[model samples]
Target chain A: MTDGTPILHMKDVRFQWPGRASFSLEVPSFEAGRGEKVLLLGESGSGKSTLLSLICGTIAADAGDVTIDGTRLSDLSGGARDQFRAETIGVIFQQFNLLPFGSVVDNILLPLRFAPERRARVSDARAEAAALSLALGLPDVQTAKAATLSVGQQQRVAVARALIGRPPLIIADEPTSALDANSQAAFLDLLFDQVRAHDTTLLIVSHDARLGERFDRVVQMADIARTTERAA
Target chain B: MMLRLAFGSLRARALTVTMTVLAIALSVALFLGVEKVRTGAKASFADTISGTDLIVGARSGSVQLLLYSVFRIGNATNNVTWQSYQDIAARPEVDWIVPISLGDSHRQFRVMGTTPAFFDRYKYRRDRGLELGDGAIMNDLFDAVIGSDVAATLGYAVDDPIVVAHGLASFTEHKDQPFRISGILKKTGTPVDRTVIVSMEAIEAIHVDWQNGAQIPGQSTPVEVIRQMDLTPKAVTAALVGVESPLQTFALQRAINTYPEEPLLAVLPGVALQELWGIVGIAETALLGVSAMVVVTALLGLMATIFSSLNERRREMAIFRAMGARPRTIMALLVLEAVLTSAAGAILGVAFLYLGLMIAQPMIDSAYGLWLPIDAPSTREALVLLGVVAAGAIVSMVPALRAYRLSVADGMMVRT
Candidate 1:
């Protein structure tokens, strides 16, 4: 269920390692509509992570442009790009998602601390975080340190953090690789429920093909990238 | 928010943070302690004798004359005759004179033979006269007035009978004629506080039978016979001269320097004291250099602590980057952590200084005869603290720059 307009658009994007001559990444044209749940399927070394970095504006392309929400990321300065990413995108890492020293609630509220626009979106940040945690099926552990939480609890906390400010786009890389099959299914159900409720666009990159059937559209790395070689 | 993040990071690594802070605190304390001691030594030296125009003594180095006359340190090469002192005092330009005879001690404290004029005219620490803490000044040949340090350390009170030892040694006791402690001077935080003051007659009485630095085996004067004999001093170590006018000091100095009776030298006390200080300043400079090196080492330790943690914190920085922290923001976080630690260390160091002074004040007073005043930091000490913090901020750039580069290179993706 997506709108006609594209939320993320890439055209003629090219990137290469500094001294590597074997393989490079090239995206001729790619677009995801608003509220589209897209699964990017690729092997471990098929340039999926690099493409994700470029999409998030963490790395610049060697050529061409990347636009998010109709704004060209390459047109912005470095600091402005960071601000844009903070306001427009929410990222979830596979491991070490939460800062171990911070409490669960602190981890969820970190995005608001960095992005004022996102913070202004909500009237009460702490209450919203508690509601989001409860909605994600996490226990009442907001006061507990992040390190004290179990892996499943930590994953839910990371999802709650990623969804706190309701950023338009959420990028998760191999988020469910460490979970058991039963836990993975349960996490995916909760993730889709929240994403659908907010009408947020999602792009999850993973080597596992088991998750492809759950997404609205699955894109293969070999189809987009010219070669499927490993990066040094 | 950045501060909160930095504090959170520090809390996560409490052991490393505490070790680095302690290193910085110890070095800072050492640096400030050395500075305090150096200044205290100089102040004690400069405050020993004041308001005296010229110090006249047998021809010798000016520093040696000032040292023996005022500091009670070292022995005079030769003694000036009493006739020379009287002649100099009778001069029209000379207002008053205090003839100081040295070379005796009581329990290792120097015994200074002088008239009551020594207490009246001798000023220290800005023209402050010596006040009597107990009893009265020496009024009899065998009556002695001890300094505050002597009375406090030896537990001597007024009317306590004490034997003066000859030749500045405790082994050679002049027990034949014991002196009574008549008074004790208040603490002046100067070398004067370590002296035992006795009249010239008492000195003469003790040395009546001793000649040429030794007692004749066959001839010894009994206490009664010595008491009946004339007790006028024949020779004195040095004399402190106060001119009728301040402008006459140079002329009188030149006159005394060229006097033909015996080769004699006159030195300005202020100038000689500075010369002595110049000699002692070398060791102080070395100590300062050592302390400075220690501060540098401590800062390097801090840098190493932060730098080594950078690898472990790579994931942390990546998370910050993903949370919209710029490279400069990451750098600031690291630098801010260092600045905070060094600042805390400096404050703790000052606290340690005062605590050490509080505990060691009495011991230092008795051991070195230097009364170190515990007070606020001088401008120089403040500068040292500022220097340490500035160096810390500058040194922190090493790790901060490294973290910035790493975050940029590995954005949102921790390889390890």
Candidate 2:
């Protein structure tokens, strides 16, 4: 994964906390092509969140290599990891995450403030913000204080923020969980379509299988021992 | 950009910032008020004596002597014999001498008895020479030239007949022989403002019937009757003298101390003022210390307010961190936020201080007869406010550190 070969490649990756008696995650090898929409499906306690953390470089894996965009996640220093994660990936949490006090535009502009490289590439950030807001169907007043919006609107703003300045990868963790069924289908359509339009790969994690058909590929996480016993 | 966020957050938490600003403002007001009065008191003291190299009076402490003679703060000790004043004033080193006889007041303001030469040579400060506001200078035996405060308080203009009490102590009213107000002085913001100036002969003529400090029992001497007696003072409270050279002060003092007629003390006005300051310095220090503690309390209150609001700021901090803000960046955000708020509070405090002084100046000058000048913060006070700003910034870190810890946990979405 540390080598400059694949856009994303994982090899024999295992992660466990220091005090834990068991490994929380294990993957011998995994690869995803550029511009791929991959759904990482998991039930409760399947370590989907743990794997997401590993991918984002928020938590270093215990063993093996996990690389994104040909840069090994483990190779990044603490500060560099933060910079790289912001520059390379747009992460969406289950809950719409926004700085409560800041205006919607300021929250969107947050990533570039951390990674100056992203700021340098975007010449017209204000225009991009307007386009991005308009694309999210965010009305002028809805973007004033993010807390003032409905859950669905907030989720869209979060998605807009994730795609703002157009990073290479989008990682969403149950980003549409709080939406109504109709809103969820509409949101998923807009989200995936935007990801395709921007040419960014998306690794979305969700427990619900009903949303699986929307992705190009669906990945099911297995119980390590049960799968091993079945393989034997 | 971070400034915008901090300011926005502060606005969101408007109640906390406003309370902090108000607390700091009151502290500044209190500090400026105390300092103004102290400075004004010192200035008034400085203006009370001028051109007089030394003031000789009956043997006593320097401050008490200065009090009765110059500031009219208290009654003088036993008056120096007239012959003793004469002996000292006759010296070759003495350029001019103004004899002063005290122990009288009207409405608690001192009435001083001196010769015409007292007004002619009496200079409270060298640069601020005597100038009359209206009417001629003292010419008649019982003519009275009033100080600015006395004129304002009693509404006495020139040629107005005003009586003098018998003693320097409060509650005495002498209705027997009232001297006319012959002249009034310009406001000097000094103790002279509260004084009534009359000739030593007027003092002698007015008290002629009162032998050995007692009026003959039931014997009434009318005002017209007093001017008929010999107007020569037996004893004078003090004498103000200008020296040929300041270097001869100690020699002059020794000469006055060893006078053959009576035991006397000569105090250099400058050294006496220093001594008087030493006498009152402890009270001033206590006041300054109290004001300083108020400032410290206000700053701590500000820190405590910010600390309380930090819990609400955790999620905001996590959002910044998740946006690729580094650990130091988060810390910088809080630090910068603290500094700006503290600086803002301090600036508001100074503005509040200026406004308070402006409001209090007239009231203090008229009501308490104390001049509160509008001036820049003293160096010590400036340093205290700066310390408040610094302490405020440091105080902000307490909340920021809490945020930092939350952000660390928030790294893996583990933060609550």
Candidate 3:
């Protein structure tokens, strides 16, 4: 009962793969309220990616209840989980996460095409995409072909894709790793602008602590314990 | 949209897709081609005579009798006595008899001598009754009616008087008994189309001056003068019987076997056709087996093509996943690409078969003596094609599952 309305909430979460030794990720309780910009930092095998999978309803935590937008993620069936992710959540990943053949704009509007409800919510989806492109400093044509662009351009397109439908939650997994420092800063700046413009809750996963100060809250994967000792 | 996307990617891999299509198309062509020919041959054999109950020929295997007398493939070793035919025709169980006299040819076309009743009850095809195409039946003892192919090939028209060059001779014999061509038959797509039909007297007229396969040396008689003498045939090659009932076939066969004058072997046309087919079934089955192997290999070609492209498509899959396409969406795309490719191959295979038939039709008819009706796929054929395309789609799924794993492993980025 920590907040009036938490955009994402995890309670006594425990996740384990089949036949694994122990739970891969454990957290007694954690929550992010609406419009909060949170940063999750971890080493390579610190279960940060696993946590993201849990959050997006890709995989269910073995022994915990997780909620996004007040809907329990684990309770959703296969189809419902897909619909939930497609309509209500957008994810941004590092590196070459794009259909190489599809045009950049097509990539950005992928979620809308999958979930009809999402398409309906964003009336004039292309218009929404166009507006979001302008907000992220990406020209409409930059969404032409994703593979043709530099890493920086691809990251910006990814940002446009994540924020296009005005989804309530946006997750990014070190989306700026490929960019130079200046390009990284610029990409981060474009990302924050769109997130704030749409009032979307942002959770960016990164190992680079130097980028930590920009986020509203920071949670390290080592802090995923079943007690409140690291909550402060 | 997914189908369009898959098709677009396939189009992008134009060469690979084209090769896959060609592989499948060639296999399908072979498969359908062999199946069609085998089926057509069986149909022709069974349908050659619709109304005949029994075939009475010289003592030989039922299949041999059928081949020589009906199909005109081999020559008969013996001839049945005309007295046996007359006695059998007089039997109460026998309704009508159409005597078929063989052993003569014009340009590889066999000549058949039969009574005028052949035009009445001797139906070759059940669907089309026997009706003469031209002038009246052969009451003119020296007249002849030509098969469609004979008339067309030799350019014989009605009322054309031509000599019967006796006894299967291609160049010269029986020059004196030149008979007139009185009528021409329409194409029946059967052995009838390749035969010269004449009265039994005409067959006798040419043989009157001959004995033991040759005209008496320097002993020739004019055909017009032979009309002054006896016109009844001394003997015949075989006889086509239509009995009161199909049940009489066994009894009549026994009667012909026990004929007092001579031993005449009799057979049911349908039974003989079946017996002949069984003999050729091995060759047909072997053909089908090889074509099926071709089909399997073509499908494997599809699989290999997709599998080879799987590594390249890793990046493609990751990119699509990054685009918010789920695993199922990627699967749909891969399946669509394979199915569409296979469908194109099937269509191309059919087209190839058609074009091949059109180009080689005449050669096939003359060389193989086969006619493959170049028509649309029957329902069974359509279903077969659908199965092939679906199987292609399923085969592509093996790659789709790989893509699924790649999308998950790649998450948002393909490392390489």
When sorted by TM-score, best at the front, the candidate numbers are: 1, 2, 3
Residue-level lDDT of model 2, residues B1-416, one tens digit each, is: 78898787777778878888788778866776677678776776666678788899998888889888887877776998877777887898888888998888777688888877776676765567667888877788878888877888878877778877787564545667767888898876667778888888888877776766667778778767776777778889998988888788778888987877777888988889888988777787789789978877887787687677666666666566667777677877877766777778778878887887788777677555567678777797788678777887787777767767666655646544
How does each model score on TM-score? 0.94, 0.90, 0.76
Q: Mind giving the per-residue lDDT tens digits that candidate 3 earns over B1-416?
A: 56656766887789989999999999998888888888877776677877888889878889999998888888888888778778888998898888988888766778788888777766665766555577656768877888777877788888887766555655665577666787887767677777888888888888888788766787877756788988788788998888898788789889887776777799888888888999898899999999988988899899889889888887677555544567787777888888899999999998988888788777666455466677878998888788889889888889878877766655544446
Which candidate ranks first by lDDT, i.e. highest? 1
DockQ for every model, please.
0.69, 0.56, 0.24
Candidates sorted by lDDT, best first:
1, 3, 2
Clashing pairs in 1: none
Please report, as a residue range, the 10-residue window in candidate 2 chain A with the lowest summed lDDT: A223-232
What lDDT is reached at residue B362 by model 2?
A: 71
Query: Could you give candidate 3's per-residue lDDT for residues A1-232 as a string of tens digits?
Result: 1247898999989876544555456877878889999988887767776777778766667888889999998888755776688778887878675666667777778777766766877878777777777777876574465667777777877788877767888989888888899998988888887788788899988899989988898988778643211221
Model 1 lDDT per residue over B33-150, tens place: 9888999999987887889999999999999999899888899999999998888889989999999999999987999999999989999877988999989999988999998989
Q: Can you give the lDDT of residue B99 in candidate 2?
A: 91
TM-score of chain B of each: 0.95, 0.92, 0.87
The residue pairs found clashing in candidate 3 are A97-B412, A98-B319, A99-B319, A99-B320, A104-A144, A105-A143, B163-B178
